[model samples]
Target: MFELLHKKINEIISLTDEEFNYCRTAFTPRKLRKRQYLLQEGDVGKYQAFVEKGLLRSYKIDDKGVEHILQFAPEGWWVADLYSFFTDEPSSFNIEALEDSEVLLINKSSWDMLLQNVPKFERYFRVLLQNNLVATQRRLMGSLSETAEEKYLKYTQTYPDCMQRVPQHMIASYLGITRETLSRIRKQLSEKK
Candidate 1:
């Protein structure tokens, strides 16, 4: 269980065995079955979860009852509602398991302790945040300016694993396209290949 976390952390920063063993104490493990809610809208987001297995997604339901996916967390990814976690506010997003998932969770207090104890993690999280911002900005730009086909192609290029694991309608929601449009795009792309 800690192996994947160790590997992921090592990829970003070096932590000695003694340091890692201490750091792991800050986190608690949780497992959720497919379709289960990890964080619900209106709830205070208490934990930032690191994915050790399976997949999770954070999304919102509009007044029209439409689901707009914000992000997906697969193995080696991190999932949380940053706003709620930091501000003690209610979460606007709902995080749900797309598949049965195992995650290591740390609350704000434990997270702070870990950072203070293992300063290297501050750097690791900084890098993670920077990359997330870049991807978010790019995705927003694409949503505003790119054509449906272009967006679909980019989505596939960006998250090929999600293409395999997520449902078709949810994929359409993520791409900000209609199910019929996604179907058309997929068919066209398939023919081209």
Candidate 2:
């Protein structure tokens, strides 16, 4: 279960075997059922989860009660509301399991302890956050500028696993398009091919 986390950490910063073992000891493994909420709206997010398997999504409900998906984390991905996790503030978004999921969870306290004990972890997390921010920015730009077909293609290319696991409507929400529009776009893309 820690294998993915270990690989992810190594990809960012190489750690000695002892350091990897020490860092791995701080994570708590959990299994979540489908539709289970990890963090709910108005609740402070207590933990950042690293996916061992399955899918999870974070979304916000609009005033009209429609869900606007911010992210979908599949196997080997990390999911968290950074603001809520770091500041203990209520989160505007809710994170939930889209499929039965296995995850390694690190709470704020544990994460702080790990950072203090393993300074290399700080570099790893900083890189992770920087990459996430860049991806978020690119997604925002695409939402404003791209057509539905382009967005769909980009999403599939980036997260083909998520496309397989997530429902079409949820993908539509994430793409900032109506379900009918997504259907039409998909049909058009298929016809083109």
Among all candidates shown, the one with the greatest TM-score: 1
For residues 1-193, what per-residue lDDT tens digits would candidate 2 score against the true structure?
Answer: 8988888788889999999888888899999999999999999999999999989999999999898998999988999998899899999999999999999999988899999999988898889889988998999899899989899999999888669888899999999989999999989888998
Off by over 4 Å in 2: none
Q: What would the per-residue lDDT of candidate 1 be over residues 72-156, giving only the tens digit for each residue?
A: 8999999999999999999999999999999999999999999999899989999999999999999999899999999988888
Q: How big is the positional error of residue 49 in model 1, measured in Å on the Cα after superposition? A: 0.7
Name the lDDT value of residue 165 in candidate 1.
Answer: 93
TM-score of 1: 0.96
Poorest lDDT segment (10 consecutive residues) of candidate 1? 155-164
C-alpha local distance difference test of each model = 0.93, 0.91
Backbone N/Cα/C clashes per model: 0, 0
- What CA root-mean-square deviation does each model show from the true structure? 1.2, 1.2
